[model samples]
Target: MPLWTIYHPANTYSDKDKQDFAKDITDFYTGFGLPAFYVVVLFTEMAEPAFFVGGRPASDTVRIVVEHLARHLDDPDMRRRSTERLNSIMVPYTRDRGLHWEFHTYESPRDLWMIAGLFPPGPGTEAEKAWARANKPLPY
Candidate 1:
């Protein structure tokens, strides 16, 4: 599964904002062949005393850490397009907040992904294709 973690100061985002953010991100990932059920979004709030930037307390900073299978990040075009889409999601939330925002992505091995008691194959792989054929589910 893909794990998207947004880190910000506590109480910075309302519940509605978080929902919208998650929905937008899920839409983007689904377009890139991820199943909606397998994608996850998380918001982690840090208290003012715990939030920091440049080695000093900075509650205004917003940070995002995304973790996904390596297959998704292995293509240059996919990575570029995803970055742009992510920027679109963040702009509305971060604009004019006087906050510094950053996003970083990390890729883990596809074989490491385990869901529903099975090891799911990476996108566009022979194993994935076979599984899809057998399960008669969407190719994603």
Candidate 2:
């Protein structure tokens, strides 16, 4: 499972912007073969004052924290590809404002996460594959 969290200042983005960000993020992860039901994204708006970068109140910036099955950390190429795509998707929203941002992927082992009372089958596993196949309204 992959869960993406976006933390940005309130005025930094419009409602539609947040909507697109979530959709784009889910698409990015699902491209890796994960099912849509397993891709969770959240947009958390915070007051600019609530965030600080280098001890200075953040004025123009975005922060993305992604949590996924620890197994994903085993692939260096995937990380590189994902980061590149993240930059492309974010440039339109960050560049014009001269904003700074970082996307950090943190590993959360399968056992550490649960979905609907069951642990994820773990990425790239047969169980995960079967679950994806059984699920509908997704990129089956």
- By TM-score, the best candidate is 1
Pairs that collide in candidate 1 are none
lDDT of 2 by residue, 25-89 (tens): 66876677777777777888889789888998987778988787625556889778767876787
Give Cα-based local distance difference scores for all models: 0.76, 0.74
lDDT of 1: 0.76
**Backbone clash count for every predicted candidate, in the order shown:** 0, 0
The TM-score that candidate 1 achieves is 0.79
- List where candidate 2 sits over 4 angstroms from the true fold: 122-127, 133-140
lDDT, residue 3, candidate 1: 86
Q: After the best TM-score superposition of candidate 1, give how far the Cα of residue 116 lies from its true spot, in angstroms.
A: 1.8
Question: Can you list the residue pairs that collide in candidate 2?
Answer: none
TM-score of each: 0.79, 0.79
